[model samples]
Target: MQLLSVNLAAPHAADYTDSAGRVTGIDKRPVPHPVLVTAPGPKGTGGSGLAGDTIGDPRHHGGDDQAVYAFAREDLDAWAAELGRELPNGVFGENLTTSGFDVNSALVGERWRVGDAEDGPLLEVSCGRIPCRTFAGWLGERGWIRRFTQRAAPGAYLRVVEPGEVRAGDRVTVVSRPEHEVTVAFWFRAVTTEPELLGRMLAAGDALPEESRERALRRGA
Candidate 1:
């Protein structure tokens, strides 16, 4: 797989409704040059991991577990066809727009070596992107959040295992795959709709975000 584009956002007034009632930085655009990717420290403390990108809401946005968001070009194309509209890369506020990758099927803890050589950035799949009201408002789609959740291919959030520069056309190699079967798609479904599968998520262990793991453990209790 390869990186189709590396996108970043600038802080701008969002015309969408959210808990903040005014959102910003959800509109990301692709950059032609390489962008530095690093850990954002932790949730609510750091902004986006991308050097120039802005995170409007830290309460739910930037964090170690969600340092980078990736979406597949193939999935965007599918949405375009379904909506009868052109869906471009980064339109979904993803940091990386990837091609030839099945991001939804990626398992939590799966490690990817992004870029050219062995020294390239290492990223670990952390969890699935959860659709929210802000996302619905941005898309202006009726029942968008519910629809996106029901579709259960909500893309993937990644943690930076090794900081490095990434750019459009960089090679993306799956360096390691977790032995567990709890893929991002499955985790999304379990958390969003299937409570029965919450216990199943525990199999992923620490690969899942601590918040998610706790939620699953609580529900399963």
Candidate 2:
């Protein structure tokens, strides 16, 4: 797979009605990526860690943190054709847009080498689906959340193994790690929907990232 674009936007303020019949103004700040490092700040909204809860107030749900979305390059082109316009900025709602990669099919604990194969940060991916209403707002509908989950292409959360500059048109390759079999999607289900598999993922040890391991522990609780 290759990078289609790297995007960032300045935070802007907007108002919306809530599920609880309240109205509020949301200030969505921009960052290098859509993944949030924590629950607040530019990193808080998007930069690649966890799919923050998306259906509620973003500040409360943590603003789509660590969310990565992707579409086939061809699909993007087709979508552009139908819309009779180029895909709008932030329309894909992803920090990195990729071509020729099936991100959803990636296994949890799978590590990708995101640069020259010799020296690059190992991006270990974990989890899927950070559903929220803002996502629906981005998609122009409520059911898009369901469609996202059902499709389960919730792109993986990555941790920098060697932190280096990643640019557009970079190639992504799976550096074969034979020990783990679980994909981020599998762990997402195990931790969120199935308690049984949490221990199993932890036991897989080095195959899983430390942050993911901690989340699994919380889920098992």
Candidate 3:
């Protein structure tokens, strides 16, 4: 697979949620140069793992488990067709717009070597992105959260395992795939709609994000 674009967010004033007049970085755009990728510590202290990018709200958006976000160009096309509007590479707030990648179907903990074998950063699939009021407001779509949840195609959030530089057109290679059925799509469905599937998410093991893993543990995972 190829990295179609490397997107970075810019802070913009948006009064879309209870926090009136808050700045948000949901509208990310493609950049021209290579960007350094590294683990941004933890969620509370860390922001976007992409060197120049910053998380507007660290309270719920950025952390080690969600250091990077990836969305497939195919998925974006599907959404465009469904929404009857053109959706660009980074329109969905994803840092990486991937081509020919099945991002949603990736197994939790699956590893990818981005760029090259020797110099690329290694990334591990962590979890599916959950929709929030900020996202819904950014899209200006009615019942956006409900609609996104029903679609069950939320893009995958990944953690940086090895730090390196990444840029547009870089190749993405799957370094490893753990034996598991807990895919990004399935996990999103289980956590949002089918609480029954919560217990099964544990099969993903430590690759699963701490937040979801804890919930699964409470469910006797």
lDDT for each of the candidates? Answer: 0.89, 0.51, 0.91
Model 2 compared with the native: what TM-score? 0.61
TM-score of each: 0.96, 0.61, 0.96
- Candidate 1 per-residue lDDT, tens place, 162-221, comes to 999999999999989989889999999988889789998999998999998999989877
Backbone clash total for model 1 is: 0
**Rank list by TM-score:** 3, 1, 2
Q: What is the lDDT of candidate 3?
A: 0.91
RMSD to true structure for each model, in Å: 1.4, 6.8, 1.4
Give the range where candidate 1 is weakest over 10 consecutive residues by summed lDDT.
14-23
Candidate 2 stretches greater than 4 Å from native: 16-90, 117-120, 191-221
- The TM-score, computed over Cα atoms with residue i paired to residue i, of candidate 1 is 0.96
Worst 10 residues of 2 by lDDT: 22-31
lDDT for each residue of candidate 3 in 38-151, tens digit (9 for 90 to 100): 999888789999988867788788889999999999989988998899999899999999998799999999999999867779999999999998899989888899999999
